[model samples]
Target: MTAIVEGRSANRVVAAAAASIAVAMVGMAYAAVPLYRLFCQVTGFGGTTQRALAPASAPLAQRIGVRFDANVAPGLGWTFKPVLTTVSPRIGEQTLVSYTATNNTDRPITGTATFNVTPESAGQYFNKIQCFCFTEQTLQPGQAVDMPVVFFIDPAILKDKQARRISEITLSYTF
Candidate 1:
């Protein structure tokens, strides 16, 4: 008679099930990175972290009032007409911004957008609560849509006191 293994109960089916469960659990653990990133982006729970197209130099303060600019680049057949609202928070407040995108191309176009905050000093405090950047945007010929973003600055920023040194903030968008 063959000697039975003591630990596994000599059952092949039981071993197979255990192996599958282990594999499945390992797979889920590996997927945690992308899953958590998706959750952050969708809910804006953490400080909005996005890959910067290129390293941006720390921003310089102009006057006491910070001046922010919006730079947008639409896809080959798309057009962007941004409608930005003025933000004058006490350096620790939330603001809303809106943009209008139009499909001027003869053919339908679908693409995504990515963005960054310049003047590393400002980026630390800038937070995007709601945005469409880095998301797939589908536009049909002559189709236009309004995109909105909600953002807020951490109150801790003011505590830095150095934050007051920052005047203008720029929120640029590139498609």
Candidate 2:
């Protein structure tokens, strides 16, 4: 009886350990994409720099809708907009993009923006050489400023078999 009780307790311990590991693994899998994005934004690996996707590409058979979205946190009161945008670019060169940010709330809003080149597959070639989107902007209430982002496409983009049909990309922001 005593041996059986000990075996059961050991089994339960092992089962609990397994359960914990499974849960942690699931959480990690769920977080992988976002964590990768954070890593890219922090370290512009493979031309993955912070900037809006500039519109300068050849037109598609039909227009693929690309939308720009802006977000400002409650404590950070600011209004942001897309001033310059992009859609097409030569494989080796970059596209330019611009945005205007205004301090709407009474206090100054200072925050950093982390952006991704969605169809993130495009991120592999989107290079932001000079981009205001990478830096934090501090605006006094009622203060409005224009931000510029200069970027280019990686030469490799032209060679990417998976990316061949992709022409238009949208860059969005959240504070």
Candidate 3:
């Protein structure tokens, strides 16, 4: 009888431990996404661009071509395109570019943009000083807006052995 009682108590402890582990796993699953996003932003992992308040003080002599691409997700009822197809700016030089977005629906719709730099290695070197993507933009029916993005290619890119040879970087945005 004592053995039976002890066996039951041991079973309860094991069950409790299993339950605790399951709960902890669920919590970690919930936390993973945001934590991963923060990690990518900080490290510029997987093409995520960095944010900065200002560009490098002095621009570099070598010029790099930057191509812009814009896209609107299906069902967003929005038209979006880059104002300029491309620009050649010296490394570390601050450049301003614009994108146009128009609302096709009768009701106001809000949009947020996500951007990335191609040649994934170049992501760490792409910095945005100001961008419409930082906040959600709301447009009324038939409303068209010109959104600006100010950015620079960090001179540090030239120092990275893998990224040094990249002559052109594509910055793509999706709304």
Candidate 4:
């Protein structure tokens, strides 16, 4: 009878431990997404661009081309396109570009944009000083708006072997 009681107690302890582990795993699963996004923003992993408060102090002599792309998700009832297909700016030079967004629906629609840089290695060096993507945009029926992005390519890219040879970078936005 003593052995039976001991065995039952051991089983209960095992069950409790399993429950604790399961709970902890569920907690971690919930935390994983935000943690991964933070990691990507900090490290510029996955082509995530960096944010900046101000432009570079002095522009570099080397010029690089930046291509712009705009897209609207299906069912959004919006039309979007870049004002310019591409622009050439000296490294470290602050530049402004615009995108046009028009609401096609009969009612106002709100949208937030997500953006990324191509030539993924250069994402860390691509900085946006001001971007419409930073906030939610609302457009009334048949309304159109011009959104701007102020940005610079860091001069530090010239020092990084992987990014130095990149002659062009593509910045793409999706709403």
Candidate 5:
């Protein structure tokens, strides 16, 4: 009789432990998204760029070409394109550019933009101080808006061997 009682008590303890582990796993799953975003922002992993409150104080003399590209998802009923195809700027020099968005549909539509820099290695050096992509945009039918993007390349790129070799950077956005 005593053996049976001990066996039941051990089984209860094992079940409790299993339940605790399951709860912990669920909590981790919930935290994964924000944690991953934080990691990307800090490390600029996987071509994820960074955001800045302001541009660097000084710029390097070396000039680099920056090209802008835009794409709209199918069925989005919007025409999106870069106002300027390319610009040459010195490292750490802040520049402002615009993208023109027009709604061709009969009703209002909202979209959010996602952007990435190419030559993947240069993503860490690209910083955007202000960008329309930071939030969702809503446009009424036939409405046209010129959205701006303010950015600069970090002068520190000159020190990074891999990033230093990059003569041009392409910033692409899609909605």
Candidate 6:
């Protein structure tokens, strides 16, 4: 009888351990997304850009043509576009650009923006001081708003062999 009780206790312990492990695994899976995003933001992995606290003190003499592009997802019922089509900026100079989003539908709609820079290799050097991406925006019917993005192309781009030849950088955003 003692042996039988011990065997049953052992089985319970094993079952409890397995349950704990399964819960831990699920928790890790949920944590992985934000942690991976943090890693990407820091490393600029996969053409993901970074955020900066301040702009570079001095800009490089070389000029880079930056084009802005914006789009609203289908069924979003919103019109979105960059206010400025293009701007030539010296590396390290802070530039402020704006995008306008208008809701044409009769009901309020919310959207979040995601963005990337072209020439994939140049993403690491593109930094934004302030951006509206990732923030939830809600607009009522016939409502329009201008969102601004403050950014600078890191002067370090000039030092990168792969990015130095890039004359044009396109910032594209999708809602």
Highest-lDDT candidate: 3
- Model 5, 1-175: lDDT tens per residue? 9999999999999999999999999999999999998887787776778899877578888899999999999999999999999999988999999999999999999999988889888888899999999999999999999999999999988899888999999999998
| TM-scores for all predictions | 0.57, 0.60, 0.97, 0.94, 0.94, 0.90
Best by TM-score: 3
Report every candidate's CA lDDT.
0.61, 0.66, 0.95, 0.94, 0.93, 0.91
Which 10 residues in a row give candidate 5 its minimum summed lDDT?
40-49
Candidate 2 lDDT at 114 equals 59
- Give the local distance difference test score of model 5: 0.93
Per-residue C-alpha lDDT of model 2 across residues 1-175, encoded as one tens digit per residue: 9999999999999999999999999999999999987787655553254443553554223333233456666667777878644445445454456778888778776888856666666666566677666677788889998887676665555567965567576666776
Tens-digit lDDT string for candidate 4 (1-175): 9999999999999999999999999999999999998987888887888999876569989999999999999999999999999999999999999999999999999999998999999899999999999999999999999999999998999999999999999999999
Candidate with more favorable, higher lDDT: 2 or 4? 4
The window of 10 residues in a row where model 4 has the poorest summed lDDT is 53-62
Q: Model 3 clash pairs?
A: none
Ranked by TM-score, the better of candidates 3 and 5 is 3
Count of residue pairs whose backbone atoms collide, per candidate = 5, 12, 0, 0, 0, 0
lDDT of 6 by residue, 51-159 (tens): 9978767887888999998887889999999999999988899899999999999999999998888878888999999988958899999999999999999988888
lDDT of 4 at 169: 97
Question: How many clashing residue pairs, candidate 2?
Answer: 12
Residue 87 in model 1: lDDT: 60
Which parts of model 4 are misplaced by more than 4 Å? none
Ranking by lDDT: 3, 4, 5, 6, 2, 1
Decide which is better by TM-score, 2 or 4: 4
- In candidate 3, stretches whose alpha carbon ends up further than 4 angstroms from where it belongs are none
lDDT of 1 by residue, 97-166 (tens): 7878788888888867655554445556666667777488888989999888766555445556665466
Q: Rank the candidates by TM-score, best first.
A: 3, 4, 5, 6, 2, 1
In candidate 4, which residue pairs get closer than 3 Å at backbone N, Cα or C atoms, i.e. clash? none
User: Model 3 has how many clashing residue pairs?
Assistant: 0
